[model samples]
Target: MRVLLVKLSSLGDVIHTLPALTDAWHAVPDIHFDWVVEEGFAEIPGWHPAVAHAIPAALRRWRRDWRSTRAERHAFRARLRAQRYDRVIDAQGLIKSALVARQAIGPRWGLDRASAREPLAAWTYRHRVRVPREQHAVSRTRALFAAALDYSIPNTVADYGLARERLPVPSTAPGDLLFLHGTTWPSKHWPEAYWCELMALAAADGLRVLLPWGDETEHARAERIAVAGAGHGFVLPRSGLGELAALIASARIVIGVDTGLAHLAAALGTPSVTLYGATRPDRTGTFGEAQIHLSARFPCSPCLTRECGYRGASVVRPACYEALDPARVWAQTRETMSGSREMAHGA
Candidate 1:
């Protein structure tokens, strides 16, 4: 069967949709699958071996320029309509995503009101499947596929694209650790001082640290971490999605504070430890992996506030992640890495 999965925008959301690929592939082992994602995260769906195509759409960028943007959208819509897929699923329950799915070739499907992240997006789907609201993002994604294909889904980690590649990493490496400290939201970031301290602890334990960057903001943070570590860390050049897979595939462990890279590492089956602050990990935490971490002690946690609510709050501080000491994260990193080594040797 030929199917098209439309999920565009936000790196984390795109990563979360990956498990649905597994469901589709499993239901129809010879399924021909294609994906439509935003330009920023176009490399993701390609990581899945089952995906026959990864079509890049730049709705966000196209919206920037009035004339050229309209032309681009028209062109893309024409191309998408030409494919005439047998089935098109809108995993991303957003108006834009729904419209994109509507442009595809066949019967449209998506989650009903309760399951959709955005209720209005449900209007775009001809076949609506009401998913369990309580399920994790991964489960919801899989459920969407299950409902679309009328196939039962088991509680299994069906990661078909995450076959680990043997990228040559250093022996003295900190046991394959990847640190992701970048996000679109300022409130989501753990303090730079905390990251520096975490790096020191990793270096002390003889573990190698890897940093991946796609833009200037993350690149700057990576540079600061390297500088703070006194040249103890490694700087990966700006790379495409394939390079990202190569980098994460080599890691024995992944650590970060609620970023797409952290989630990607988890999706790739690398043991991941993610730190949560303003947003609840329950809504969007690392999944399909055994190793995960979260911190929700702050009274104002999961506020869903973009900027720290210090402006109007009486406390006037970044309460959510302010108290998360680097020492604790470092200790956890050490333990996780040690655990990976022990399991490897059966010690």
Candidate 2:
């Protein structure tokens, strides 16, 4: 069976869909997938063996320079419509994703109005699956696939099904820690001073630290962290998603704020500690073995706000992050690493 999956943009959401692909592939080995994802994340779907093609959709880019990118968008749509798919699943139940699914040549399937994040998007689908909203994002996607494909949802752990061997190992020694501090939201950031303290703790523990960055702002922050590391931490060169994945796969442990790279690390089966500040991890936290989520216990936490709204004394900073002390994070990191080792040794 040929299927077209529409889950575009944002690294974490795209990664969350991988397990569903794995489930579908295991149930029907002959099934092949053609995934439509944002151009920036097009490489993700190809990581799964069952995905035959990773079609790049440039809705975000096109909206910026519609006239200049008209030809490219036309070409992309042409390529997408070239093959007739047996079914098209809109796992991302947003208007933009639903519109993308409509462009394909198949009966569009998606979450029903009651279950969809955007009720308007449900109208675009020929078939709507009623998935619960309270479940984890990975589980929701798996359930959606099972309902759409007419198969029983398997009661198994979420398997990302990424080809780990495809990534080249970096020249890093064992016990090295990768710090993922770059995130989109201000509220999601762990205090810089806290990061420095964590680096010092890692240094005392004789573990080398590596910091990866995305943009100039994040790069500057990483540079500061490296400087504060006192020769124990170093800033990594700007890398693409694949290269970062390779780095994460090679790391002994990863300490990160709530970000897509953290999710990627968990998907890669890396031992990671993800600190949650502004957002709650109940539904969207990383799902994998050796993954630990440390949520902020502040009263105003999990507000899900993009910007920080703390009007208290400047000394207090963001109260949400105070509970996640660097020492506490380091302790958890050590514990997670030790647990992972024990599990590997059948302890």
Error of 1 at 168 (Å): 12
lDDT of 1: 0.76
Poorly placed runs, candidate 1 (over 4 Å):
158-160, 163-175, 310-317
Per-candidate alpha-carbon RMSD to the true structure: 3.1, 1.5
lDDT of 2 by residue, 291-347 (tens): 899998777888798887977654445667888898799889898888877888995
How close to the true structure is residue 127 of candidate 2, measured as C-alpha lDDT? 98
CA displacement after TM-score superposition, residue 127 of candidate 1 (Å): 0.9
Instruction: Assess candidate 2 and give its lDDT.
Output: 0.88
